[model samples]
Target chain A: MSVNVIEAGGLGKRYGGTWALRDCSLAIPAGHVAALVGPNGAGKSTLLNLAAGLAEPSAGGVTVLGGRPAGSRAAADGIAFVAQDTPLYKNLPVADMLHLTRNLNRRFDQAYAQGRLAELGIPLKRKAGKLSGGQQAQLALTLALARRPRLLLLDEPVAMLDPVARHDFMAAVLTAMADDGVSVVLSSHALAELERVADYLVLLSRGRVQVAGEVEDLLASHRMLTGPAADAGRYAERPVVHLQRGEAQAHLLVRATPHDPVPPGWEAHPVGLEELALAYLREPGAGALPGPARGRSTQTSEVTR
Target chain B: MDIDKEIRTEGRPGGGDGETAPAGRTGAGSPVEFRLDAASGVPTYLQLVHQVEHALRLGYLKPGDQLPKVRDVVAALAINPNTVLKAYKELETKGLTAGRPGQGTFIQATLSQVTLPELAGLRRSLLGWLASAEAAGLDEDGMVALFSSALRDFFNRRGGSAGGRGTAGGETEGVA
Candidate 1:
């Protein structure tokens, strides 16, 4: 069996008294592409940071390659983390960046890195800042991929890419994954891309995991139904993720089963991962505090003064 | 069971004489079969492309089997209209599938000449994996076991029905 590459257990993070994330648990299976998605301040980046050992969790912990995230040589060498905006030296050329990364990383695959850069027709001497946003993202992606890491963590890796560039980047990612069998966990706002590429999904809202599972399982567990209000309670116990009521017709998002029978007068339709994520985020009491954390935000603000 | 529901009905804008059927399946007198999973990581268009390619490879989709229209796919899959167009456009670019205005897309006359570039891509991918496998301390037996189990799982997921399967191992034949 392929090894489990990454796991987060009851992961939580707080900034001062404000909890950015709370009680999140998920796993990235070996050789699979998992996408983490949510709204602003939803703790996606925070989770990535925690997993990469760049930040410490306040309530729980994570592991990479069966080791703790912090200072574990095996975990550090086996995983590669690509941060947002992909800050790079403005004066550094593409070759320079690769060389620096190679020097710093023991598992770096120099030939593969060079080959990927060549495939994209990027000039070796071109400065990082001189390249367009799409090109920079590509360069960053190339660097991360060249490490030949067992696990890859990317936060908003494609957010800055244009449509064509984004498509190319995704193709490159898939090609690499297919070639190396590397596991990936990419956090992105590109719902369409996630829909097309993600094998597993972890939806975070207000710093908590609303849902996480394989793509097929997640889709099977949620469905969209349109009908009158009289039968609203018919699917009440189906873990209603989201609901909308109209004058004559009401739209309800129900957590479904693959073999669940269609309710009377209501036809079930597949809901995309993007729609399901939004539904989870929009649910009331979804991000509610566990205990006294609700009033602590103001107190923390006062203390910072 | 309702694979034909999403076939497109629109005739090519500039091409004449709308052919109501998908090209690869026309005049074969054999029923065309396709399976599309909405939850697959591969894009729906690519999935459709590969399905048609697989049919061609298997000879089930002869040169002129009158494939379903794009609208039929949209209706059956409940997918957006543009995605179907994109898939058709991609197929047209590859020359394996064609679209004539007023006429729907069809299999190009030379549909079986799988391109050299495609083969080279497959080779490169396999070589890369082999290298990584070696680096990761996996042996030939491990590789064989992994692939074997994966294929077994695939067959099981496909419900163990190898219907209309040809006796010949056609996977490696007639390729560049």
Candidate 2:
């Protein structure tokens, strides 16, 4: 049986009585490239931070590779995280950075680290602060990869890179994943790029997991149905994620089993990843709070504040 | 290994239509590069499958043609390896291709082509009919609608016996 690389059960993180991520429970299988997508302030970074063991959750728990995060030495050894800014010692030379990584992690692959730098034409004597944005991102990825972690979590790693740099970085990541079988969970706003690389998707909205599952399965399950504007309660068999009304028709995004025949007078069409993600993010109260969270839904209620 | 090297060197320089060096190139193992259109509504894996099927129907690929390695496709497209694997698996399920351990994927079945002797005559007649429709001030969309409706009526009149033939036109004609 394939083990889940990361499992969060009712994971919640709060700051000053405001929950950043609440009741976000999802399981990502090992060796899968999972994409964490949401609008800004959707608590994407908070979830990644919790998974990376950088911050403690205010409520509930999360486990990485069968061990609680940020708790045991074994757990630390199994994970590598590259933050959004690709933080590095600004004054340290590239070679010194490599040395620092080797000294810090026992499993650091020195030859691989140096070889990748040389391959990318990154000079060893140059200071980390002087490198280009793309170069810095590559260096950060190389550091994470050299550690040979079983799971890698990256937050917005490509948000700042150019198109070419993004492509090159993703190529390197894919090659590394193929070579080492490292499972990756990356948060990004680039939907098109994510659709290409990610097999699993986790969509967050208002600090909750709006949708989480395999990409193909998700695409197959949810469909866009257009028909006369009428009550949506008739389709109680399927979960309606979003509903929009037009002058003479209503558009609904519902999750249903593949091959299930569409209801009469309703036109069903397949939904793309971009369209699906946007629908969930745009529609307020589309995914109503689960019964248990009704009393604690104050954070999401203050949308404008 | 030698075959892979030959494909890498010769296939890249040959452009899309180079037919030079026909040895080990005519059968199911002929190398064909796959491409993806991100903007297209069709899923990426379905696009790959359609391209292979199109190549087969066009005789660019034949029984025994070897497909590009999954790693090669992943590196070239910057796509998830699972996507490539899924496309290959879909093709396998359709009995169009099969995987051989360490030997890559090979085309297992040939797509049937329209080899009717009277096809040229039928094409000429259809072109004549299209010209008449144009003369009648029918736009492209109108002509398509009329022709598709007529074709559907023709099939329906045939007692719909051809329903399960896997004909592309028959499947799409019912959508409207």
Could you list the iRMS of every candidate?
12.7, 9.1
Residue B132 displacement (Å), model 1: 61
CAPRI rating of model 1? incorrect
RMSD vs true structure, all candidates: 18.5, 8.8
lDDT of each: 0.67, 0.76
Q: Name the regions of candidate 1 deviating beyond 4 angstroms.
A: A68-70, A284-305, B1-50, B53-176
lDDT of 1 by residue, A241-267 (tens): 578877667788865553666677887
- For model 2, residues B1-176, the per-residue Cα lDDT tens digits are 11122333434344443422212222223467775556567787887898788776556666677888776666556678788889999988877788989888887675644433455567789999999999999999999999889888998998886742334331121111
Candidate 2 local lDDT, residue A27: 78
Residue-level lDDT tens digits of model 2 in A1-305:
36888889899999998999999887778878999988888899999888888899898888888655644678788899999999999899999999999999879999999999999999999999999999999999999999998898999989898766786687778777777788889999888778778988888888988777787767776678888887455664455778888777888887654466777888889988878778877864654633112223422223212
TM-score of 2: 0.78
Best by DockQ: 2
Error of 2 at B123 (Å): 11
lDDT of candidate 1 at residue B137, scale 0 to 100 = 88
Off by over 4 Å in 2: A230-238, A288-305, B1-30, B112-176
